[model samples]
Target chain A: MTNRHDHRLIDGRAVQARILTELRAELERERAIRPVGRLLSVSIGPSPEIEVYVRNQARGAERVGLPFERQLWPADITQEECKRRIAALNDDAEVLGIILQRPVPAHIHVRSLQSAIHPLKDVEGMNPASIGNIVYNDVALAPCTAAAAVELVRETGLNLRGLEVVMIGHSEIVGKPAAFLLMAEGATFTVCHHMTRSVAMHSRRADVVVVAVGKPHLIGPDMIKPGAAVIDIGINQVSAPDGTLRILGDVDTDRVREVAGWITPVPGGVGPVTVAMLMRNALTAHKRQVASGWLPPATLRGP
Target chain B: MTNRHDHRLIDGRAVQARILTELRAELERERAIRPVGRLLSVSIGPSPEIEVYVRNQARGAERVGLPFERQLWPADITQEECKRRIAALNDDAEVLGIILQRPVPAHIHVRSLQSAIHPLKDVEGMNPASIGNIVYNDVALAPCTAAAAVELVRETGLNLRGLEVVMIGHSEIVGKPAAFLLMAEGATFTVCHHMTRSVAMHSRRADVVVVAVGKPHLIGPDMIKPGAAVIDIGINQVSAPDGTLRILGDVDTDRVREVAGWITPVPGGVGPVTVAMLMRNALTAHKRQVASGWLPPATLRGP
Candidate 1:
């Protein structure tokens, strides 16, 4: 019998490291000329989960020599106020990118606020316009999680063109955008979601399978095609027997790795890469702003 | 052998008539109070094909009691001139909706001109912003062809939620938007395009299949599941043995109808419904503009 651990485990940390290294060098080059812009993160109220993620992002930005700022608004802030604040940020020249943290106040219309972010500074790529542009194959700025999944597949040295990818999840932020990005790359793909009758039927036939349904271990070994690359985008919290919370992904990593030629692990897989992609997007947003004459090109002049 | 002609063919003309009847009644009600708005269509240069379609649209508009106007532009017009004209239409209070005919002069960036049309007046729903709004399930003014396909599926009276649907082709105007609309309806769907390997594999498993690849007879009887609902969105021109031209759809309708319980015919299937959908969208666009306070509420007053 073959051991599941013997299969290749996609190294998300390595990919993240490579991205940060490149970003660090780029930051150094830009800093030598003019002041680099800061990433603005807006959070309504506080949640321990969001704090941990925000801290991780701050660390990642620091390592890459990128400036980061966190803005905490009162929990009672009205939706209008949020949109107004986001619009102000859109106009701020110093704010290169804006990220409205998830799990915002229940009263907040998250999609409305997301749309208020200027597409140029929408570093998180949560804006509908950015996702829509994917239809036209204009992917300068795409959703981070979706882009990360595509990157992991590309890391396997696979040619995206004509590749068969089955994506299980159709959320606007993840599944749909990822499918669109893959389509743009010339890969024929399928999108499945909660309404899907048989997820395995599609997964078993794909060269690449991306599961982002937020259901722990929803995809098993039987669902994966042998030699296929599996990207697990789900990050679910499960209570262990010891009453400790554990992070889990959509795929049964251990069992799937036995069948899949390559697979991404739960904690170390798409999560780290998503953060790295966020930083990359910020840099991209800045460059685009410069190219579009939104910012002064002279700002890059060396002292 | 079972007769394929026995299966219930989704009648596009019937559905179109149903929609027009409803629109006519509503238009009469609105007209009793104030002058309703007109749908403006801008066509660059002359094409007999486009004229035929535009004439069909005029008839549909007349049937619905809505005002219609067509603006013809010189073929040698610059892109700037095109955008300038579209912007003027955007500012026109009397124009409820705008349609930019296809096959514009070769030099014009068609997409650029589409983007200039105000989203409210974008009756065709070809603008990126309108397409992007589908991400949030805002179908107020979705693309007519895509929406028409969805309407055909709804006409089958099959609950879309949890239905297995296979969509062939991924063109921005048809496949992608249709997929998005189905996703919004809670349907499990797969999108297959030219890069897809073995399109039959996905088609055979679908409870509902929609083909919009513009290839005649791309899907045959062998590809369909028994008792499934088939919606054909393709409009292809083929040459007959006698060198006569004929219209065709993506599916081999006759053979597939033997296996499929519900199917739409080629010329009479999605085509007429699409024209009706255009008129429906025009009315929807007008309503949305009024609701958003962009237009006078008095226009919707009753007798």
Candidate 2:
């Protein structure tokens, strides 16, 4: 049971489930018109962390009625091989939505595969065309995690317009795109990272906080706004003194809940929401392809 | 005489002259390979202010031995008409580079024209494709003002790695892109606008300060690093008590020069550097078009 000290925990499991349910209906609507919705993920290694992340994302896709393929290559795969796979996905008509999961083998720089992905099927928004579309207000997709964070905050019925929101971290996947996302929603924001003078100083004055630095409990109650909303985006499992593994948020969830009016827990918060968003993007991507008369000949259902 | 305080001003005037000289040599080089580069500017309205900026930029173009044409439309011109003229220039074989002067009638939106311009001729980096190219780190041009300000700072011989930078604006045209530009160079930065907190605190700690908020004298001597370099990117002219117009920067120049080791005066600092950068972009645009082998017969050039 959740207590007052924990405030109201954001049920990411339920949120993601409900969002995927909505997506399933959209997928049916899309399929009725054209049955060519397929999703692809480009993976480089077999690390436990990367595997679990992609595994759950696949589950979410299945629930939302999209076929997912995990193209696993060796850890030491050459950059050329990775690019070849991406180009193949671009050429493959069956694959509508593509996500090249991050922490991509350090050798495989993200920028190399951007041009390889078809801009319409770029669900992960790692490509510049997708990001530019978001920034320029064109009809285009956004990076899943950043877009999910923004939509989740909005789902909480939080009014972002003209709100003093402070975002900590600036990875292309989260921070930079999220700033532009909220800016589009009329919430002026400040982005602080390792290079910033004081992260807490900016966080304390904000009405809403989105912390995605991925460090365990990096943000504590002392750094939060009184009665503010906290969304913890870190999925870190740190070993305790007793040799036990404990999942933690970028925020000290225990202390922050007492001060925050609304809070999203670590494991159940942004993590699940990201998968749901990806599934939604897949449906949208397939719909565009079908409408443009470019889908593969996989008509599973009738209109 | 320019004193030691102004010793290494990077003298925008001198830099502009040198760039034009190089542009002329490049013209000869280009003519030897292909055809001469030509420039065209589409300025809306006869606002003397817009006219002055356009004229100065053109003068910089001429100083480099490149010829140019100017098309001035009425201030009441519709967005459709402006775009039509811009499209004509874009399709014109003689026009290798197109400069669309800003402050477009206060009611017309320029975004409509952003996607239509050839990425090669987008000297301002205002086009969506150019912005996308920057985000992806592809081979593309940057906004002239941001590129110039960065060059002027590096021209002073400072290594930007891990350096503290305070940018006092958030416009895509100047401050925001400048932050990304500096960050790409490994400099840590903080972007501030009307909404930032304790801006003075951030500014004083910067090893380098770039103020582009367009407010006259927003920064004072106290808001500067001792012996720090200042590049004023503002172009504001305010009337004094005696009814005379005076140009000032976001920084208080008179007192800041005492504490600041180097400074670029408001009028001559970033302004001339921007024009020089534009010429450089124009030449580069011409080269790309020539190399692409798609130049129309009338405007065709070869590499």
Highest-scoring model, TM-score: 1
TM-score of chain A of each: 0.95, 0.91
The alpha-carbon lDDT assigned to residue A44 of candidate 1 equals 95
RMSD to native, candidate 1: 2.8
Residue A264 Cα positional deviation in candidate 1, in Å, after optimal superposition: 0.9
DockQ of candidate 2 relative to the true structure: 0.24
**Candidate 1 CA-lDDT value:** 0.87
Which segments of candidate 1 are over 4 A away from where they belong? A1-7, A30-35, A299-303, B1-7, B241-243, B299-303
Query: Residue A13 error for model 1, in Å?
Result: 1.2
Residue-wise lDDT of candidate 1 within B265-286, one digit each (tens)? Answer: 9888898899899998988887
Local lDDT at B180 for model 2: 67
lDDT of 1 at B194: 83
- Chain A of model 2, TM-score against the native? 0.91
Candidate 2, residues A81-170, lDDT tens digits: the string is 877877777777877878877677788777767757887788877677676666565534777788878877886687766676778877
Q: Each candidate's TM vs. the true structure?
A: 0.94, 0.74
- In model 2, the Cα lDDT at residue A34 comes to 57
For model 2, the local distance difference test gives 0.76
